[model samples]
Target: MLIGYARVSTLEQNEDLQVDALKAAGCDRWYVDHASGAKASRPQLDKMFELLREGDVLVVWKLDRLGRSVQNLIELINRLHKMGVGFKSLTEQMDTTTPGGTLVFNVYASMAQFERDLIRERTNAGLRAARERGRVGGRPSKLTHDDEVMIRQLYESRTVTVRQIADRFSVSRGTIYRAIEAGGVAQTEN
Candidate 1:
């Protein structure tokens, strides 16, 4: 069975072109999405993945329609391969079911990996440069040490609820829980 997957970045885009192409390529059935490929969560994609079985080939109108990044593409292909399924890109004219197609796909996967490595190297170098210049990255903490200490005191003393503390600090309940876990203290004294 040739299972098709199609997508458009926004609701304004039409699926007719991709659907037509997939139908022309002999797709027996399809899953379509009206969302960005950058989004990790897609209901139709997840549904299609669950419906796929061994010997079925997953087809897409284009590579970008199926994947947003090399790492993500390779990961999905690896999963499909493990399930004894094949992958095909109509525009790229590449398939993983044949030896020649498999070679080409392998080359593509390698190039994606190389691109990913280059990105990582660049990011690391930028971080190192920032460190040398006495700068740090990452978001600033939402709560101060005193706020955490007060949170611990309030919780242990049963004076305030987790929700109350989170609201007061403008953080989530999970942050308070993590702080308590990391601090390893149940109470505090003034």
Candidate 2:
């Protein structure tokens, strides 16, 4: 049995290319998801893993689409191999059933890890430079002190509902609640 897996990081991304490639590759069954690789849980990936069995072949459009990290990808592939399942990545020309293909997969995996490490290194360096320049990181405050005061006053008066308060502040109810919980607003005595 040949099972295909396709994924796109977001809904805005089109899966047509991967889907077409998988179909052309003669996939008998397939799964797909529109979810970020950073997310640990993906419904379609979970389903595909569950449905795969011994002697079955799992095909993917690309390896990165299957996993975000080299460790995770290695673990997944090793698990499948142990289960007597075969794997293939169309774009990478990787296949688990052959020795040469396995070597290629390993090399690509190492390269992927290296690429990720470089990205992290560059990001940290950039942040350090920005900090050295006296630039602050993270999001600016959504509400000013004046806004907090007004929010507290409104909440104490009980003239407007929490939802109304959130609307007036242009923030979510959860954000409003967090502000109140974090002592952003004055507390009213019961």
Q: Which candidate's TM-score is highest? A: 1
In model 2, which runs have C-alpha deviations exceeding 4 angstroms? 1-50, 60-79, 181-190
The 10-residue segment with the lowest total lDDT in model 1: 181-190
lDDT of 2 by residue, 1-190 (tens): 9899998989999999999999999999889999999888899999998989999999999988888778788878988989899999999889998999889877876897889899999999999999999998988879997887777777878888778989998998776776676665655432
Highest lDDT against the true fold, candidate: 1
Q: How does model 2 score by TM-score?
A: 0.60
**lDDT over C-alpha atoms for residue 174 of model 1:** 84
Q: Please give the RMSD of candidate 1 to the true structure.
A: 3.8
Q: For model 2, state the Cα shift of residue 37 in Å.
A: 11
Clashes of each: 0, 0
TM per prediction: 0.75, 0.60
